[model samples]
Target: MNKKRLLAAAMSVLVAGSMLLAGCGQKDVKQAGSKPEGAAYKFRLAESNPAEHPVTLGDKKFAELVKERSNGRITIDVFSGAQLGEEKAVLEQVQLGAIEFTRVSASPLGEFNKQMSVFSLPYLFDSEEHMWKFLKGEMGEKMLNDLQPSRMKGLAYYTGGARSFYSVKPLTGIDSLKGLKIRVMQNKINMDMVAALGGSATPMPAGEIFSALQTGVIDGAENNYPTFVAQNHYQSAKHYILDAHQRIPEVLLISKVIWDKLSPEDQKLIKQAALDSVDYQRDIWAKTEKEAEAKVRDAGVTITEVKDLKPWQAAVKPVIDKYSADFKEALDGIDKARK
Candidate 1:
């Protein structure tokens, strides 16, 4: 069999093993639902990235703050590297209260909250500064609060920086994208964005990206500097373009089912800790992203910077127009934030 099929079969077996383990540990995991009054509580936090990634660092920091603030009454174990499951499966577990918490990209979240898909729309944020402005204001809080209906609580937004196309093939500019099969998240807007840019979109889980690139199953993928380096996609995809197509934020979420069981005081404490962790995460994220770029360059990868986003932006205008009506409020808010 070819490498792509072999990798897929291996991952399938691993996922099955993880599910079997979860089944055996269901009783212990469900204990998170029953917190005794004024007693110690132990829970799990799922992260798909490696333990050393910035988001995982944020997850650990958040857990540390929670433990310290709770005076040892609350302790969280972080399961990184998809030890629990992939993003979608872990999200389902969180929704069912089987998993207490998870840190996931905003892309997969569109499945639960349609409003989330708005973030995946191309060029939605003029810059990272604009994104933070929207995320830290009323609109951001509203977006978080809106998650109650989905059985999840959005605590705070972690910086994911900008996502650009990286490929095994050299990407000179927008024209280089034509005929390339780029892997994208399973979000429709993301798929549409790639299609509008003249490439075929191959939707797959994040875990499958590295192998897909190595095996020629996909020619390119889009993501931020930290992710391209952290996930080691840079190793296989030697060309990086600074298109900054989308700046989707990663969210820290907890199961509302477990959250509702906590005392209001505890809830307040946890939320505050999560918010504080974002500040810590942002500091490291900036540094890590810079270092990531330098590291990849040292490895002899070609990093292309786009001089004019006007053409790229113009190309995806149809996609923007198609989704404009559906996300009028979000688009309007984003527009207002740019100033």
Candidate 2:
């Protein structure tokens, strides 16, 4: 077989095996009912973010909400900071019902669902509101439900905020990125986005970025304000530019193994709790961005906001065109959401 077909076939086998292992038996949706005395099931939810990160806070809120909604019968033990394992490993365990839950950036999720790459594509959404409108709308719902075949059921999406470019030196515009080695998630789309912007894309693990910046292993990296500051990456890469490239949403995923085994009533409650937590998480995120930016400035970081992003957008047009060919329908759905 050719490489593409072989890869697709391998993915199919992997997903199919996972489904059988996870007992993928989804039932028709039922109307929400009052919380029951519930089967006292204790499950695990893993997160890689720091304990104080908004994503972790959202997980805590979801756990709290689930306990309250279930009257404490269904307990979720939340593991923060990769106490379990890295995201890909936790995801594997989750698929096999070894772990019950996880919250992750939609970027890694592209490994499971290629359509998810749309999120990693630069400048896909015009604004944060536009991104949400697409995510919370029909196409978004379809994407969440689509995870079933992968032995994953996406419960809801939380705001991860926009990722921007930060460098050891100041970034003036689209031209500023030329030939700089920028760290990106080890994903093709992300790499392409950086390359399209005229930078050499260096894919590396999140854990290694600080050292990479400090030791000149990389020239800079892109991420949200809080992450840039929290990692003390500011000390190494002092220039912060608000190109706001990718506003990739965070995904809350449950094991289809665990999900299918749940009583439909329990499933409804879990979904409700997760959806409710989205608003709470977004509120925390807004306050956090401001707080992180202020603190970075206080630490003597040069922060630049790109009000006119036309040049930056234009630079990544090829990345957009390439994905558009493969994901035209998906791209159109997002465009529709813009209205």
Best-fitting candidate, scored by lDDT: 1
Candidate RMSDs in Å, in order, are: 5.9, 6.1
lDDT of 2 by residue, 244-315 (tens): 999999999999987887787899899999999999999998998899989999999887889898898888
lDDT of candidate 1 over 66-139, digit per residue (tens) = 99998786788999999988888788777767778899999989988989888999998988899999999888
The models' CA-based lDDT, in order, is 0.88, 0.84
Model 1 CA deviation exceeding 4 Å by range: 1-37
Q: What lDDT does model 2 reach?
A: 0.84
What are the runs in model 2 whose C-alpha is more than 4 Å off? 1-36
Give one clash count per candidate, in the order shown.
0, 0
Local lDDT at 307 for model 2 = 84
Measured with C-alpha atoms, the lDDT of residue 6 in candidate 1 is 52
Deviation in angstroms for 212 in model 1? 0.7
